[model samples]
Target: PGRGRRAGSRRVYGTLEDLLGGDIFSDFFRTFFGDFERAAGRRPGRRAEQELEVTLADAYTGAVKPYDIIGPDGRAHRVEVRIPPGVRDGDVVRVTVPGLGDLSFRAKVRPDPQFERKGDDLYVEVPVKLTTCILGGEVEVPTSTGKLILKIPPGTQNGQVFRLRGQGMPRPENPSQRGDLYARVRVVLPTRLTDRQRALFEELARLETAETYAGAR
Candidate 1:
């Protein structure tokens, strides 16, 4: 009877791995869980937000809310995603959700003008027609022998443009013609950085100043 009890107890008291089911979904396997949130909180002399959420969406894309991550302290946080710009009907977008994962989906951008900000924090409204083709898809170029792929980098800016000759909209009077594609670029900086990293950066600045002083002579 004692032997049977021992076996039952062993089975009941499984390892932490067993409780979590698998390594892929386990805490150890995650790249960044609350790292960003925690870092944000620590820097500003406050706790990382216990309850936080960000929502991104559009009328056509509907609502997409990724899985919420629970901190060790039992706080729930979720990230909300808005529909991507420039995707017409049947177009696909690669959505990245930290901690939870990434996914792709099909959606469309409304024909109405959309307003968004640039890296400099300037806001601008862009017409749908000018941005329709470049959203979520790469522009392809044809050479004499084969083809070339041109990818537009993320965080594109306003008024900046990419010129792909003969890639523009077809003219009504010219059936054999097409228009070029122009894409803008946007750059973003994280709101904060680690203390160690900031110290290193400051050291670099000092070094650069020393070099400049030496060159002046």
Candidate 2:
């Protein structure tokens, strides 16, 4: 009778071990955890944000960029990002990946040396020769598209602003519409003057004084 009792105890212990170490236990825990998460209104994954730096030209022309991000499993993933035209700085782009939560990209536009942007307008300083400022002529001006020859009016003063329509940055909302470009004139004076040039200026100064002061006191 004792031997039978010992055999029954061993059988009960073996069954308990099998129950604890089998797929049934795993399924039970998974269901419990899933139900708990649903009841708590929580998700199982995380979201990530990253920053991408782009040039002003790229923002104007649009481009395909690539990025690498770290995954939850400590692995690296390469992602290709499609950038649209007319994306301003501080714009946020969202991308979704399968099995992963939403990924956000914050855009940062780099500064350009030739132009200063304000809203949709672009400002540039174009140097004009002193002779061109005094005498009307054409000067080469740089634009987003290409170089343009701009006519300078006679006696154009330094710091004078000239507006070129439809030559500025594209509007972010509507890329087909563009803003204006303002080009400020910067007069470049002659540093070294020849003897004949100095003599001619002196003669002109004397003539100016006599012609203007002859009628005055």
Q: Rate the local accuracy (lDDT) of all candidates.
A: 0.37, 0.68
Worst 10 residues of 2 by lDDT: 5-14
List, residue by residue over 1-217, the lDDT tens digit for candidate 1: 2223112122111233343342323332232354655544557854222211211123222344343344444444443444332223444445565544553333433233322312111122222222333343454433212344655444334344555555333332342554443434332334576999789778968777564445332
lDDT, candidate 2, 108-206, per-residue tens: 777899988887788999999999998889899998768888999997888889999988878878889888889999999888889999898789687
True-structure RMSD, every candidate: 21.9, 19.9
Model 1 Cα displacement at 71 (Å)? Answer: 66
lDDT of model 2 at position 12: 14
The best candidate in terms of TM-score: 2
Clashes of each: 14, 0
Worst 10 residues of 1 by lDDT: 48-57
* TM-score of model 1 vs. true structure: 0.24
TM-scores, in order shown?
Answer: 0.24, 0.70
